[model samples]
Target: MFKKAFFAGIPVAILCLGLLTGSCQSTGTNKRDKEGFTAIFDGKTLQGWEGDPTYWRVEEGALVGEITPTTLLKTNSFIIWKGGTPADFEFKGSFRITTDGNTGINYRSEQLTDIPFALKGYQADIDGKIRYTGQNYEERGRTTLAYRGEKVTVNTQQNAADPESFRANVKNNAWQARQVTGSLGSSDSLQTFIKSNDWNDFHLIIKGNRLLHYVNGKLMSDVTDNDTVNRKMQGLLGVQVHVGPPMKVQYRNLRIKQL
Candidate 1:
């Protein structure tokens, strides 16, 4: 009777172990699928990215880009992600920049083989000076499409006579600005939301020709691109280490979900 009882218990123990392993695997998958986003950075290495090793690396679980005075670039360089090109998606990340550092998240961009890791397209600007931070900029293209706290509708057919004309058009439509309320009254108010030398959360949402940039949970810029002639629908994604001064920018918790 004792031998029969011990043999029967072995099968029960095996079944319990299998159930525990299956439960753990399911939990991990659910955690990664939270909010329908997947992490782009592994927090260990630059395995799925392409860039000059001299300027980009993983440090302390963050993707770090640094340029010393001795290694100043003649033109902006980027670390391009080799992952799939996302047409419509939401990107979320946390960043910290030095006082002299200038960086950006470039999306829907194209690479320039002539310049070695050079990218040109839409850039969600980031700067330590707080001047261009939270703006929608086109790299090597149309330049600043929208500034902080401005809601802009770009009519590619309407050619402005000068820079002032373009600025006037954007401001005239200020009443249409999205996500401006309470603490986020104006562009200056948005600037106050930035932490400067400390970490700040950035969110970029793009669907079709519309783009929105948010910093620290505040909407900083809104753009509706009507430039069908030159606008990009899809391209590469990259992070920039701008040319000039010794500076460092660190990014972590990078994730995106294609919509």
Candidate 2:
């Protein structure tokens, strides 16, 4: 009887060992899926960022920027990330804003010498009213590259004698270089996905000359920039508080994965 019982237990022990090995493999695969991403914000302090102290701070685990009734801004200010210039990358974050807030995330940008913490490049625009949220606005650059719910391609004018002259002449008119390739959805319908006065997930996939923006897992804008003179391939990254009425904007969970 003892010999028979011992022989039967051997099969059960082998089956238990196989199950444990399978569980360990699954955990390792999950870690591998999240391997490349690097968190930019520490969530407790502004260690790797710079901006005007009067308007920017770390509050309740979020990077907060506010313009009070007394502290109105003369011009737009930005809190720039000191991390390496990411050329081809994926960026992810979340934001919440007041009803009248105007803020944006600037990437592939040049820092202005005249104004402290001023940047000019592509912006992922956000507003409390959701009017311009998810639009691609070039901050102090070519203005609107791709509005919400649109896919656009930017081409330089071949016959223009001067590229700088051409850019300045059509600063407000992006139609000169932009061609609508397709539509993602209606702007009003996309707005329904965003949360008012609550945190919403935002993502940007920028590779080569193509840039894509998404909000709450929905594609918001797409742009294929072929303009060599005006478009930037790599530069600094920052978040902005626009020059407007008293408003507040907060950002959290900032991370990047370089491609």
lDDT (tens digit, per residue) of candidate 1 on 1-259: 0011110011121222222222322223223455766566778777667777778889999999999867778888788877656678889999999999999999999998677778999999999999889988888766777778777776553444356454444443231222322232577878999998999999999999998899999998888877765578888888999988999999998877667
Q: Which candidate is the best by TM-score?
A: 2
Task: Return the clash pairs for model 2, or none.
Answer: none
TM-score of each: 0.79, 0.84
How many Å off is the CA of 69 in candidate 2? 1.0
Off by over 4 Å in 2: 1-35, 158-164, 167-175
lDDT of 2 by residue, 111-147 (tens): 9998777999999999999999999999887788898
Q: What is the lDDT of residue 228 in candidate 1?
A: 69
- How many residue-pair clashes does candidate 1 contain? 0
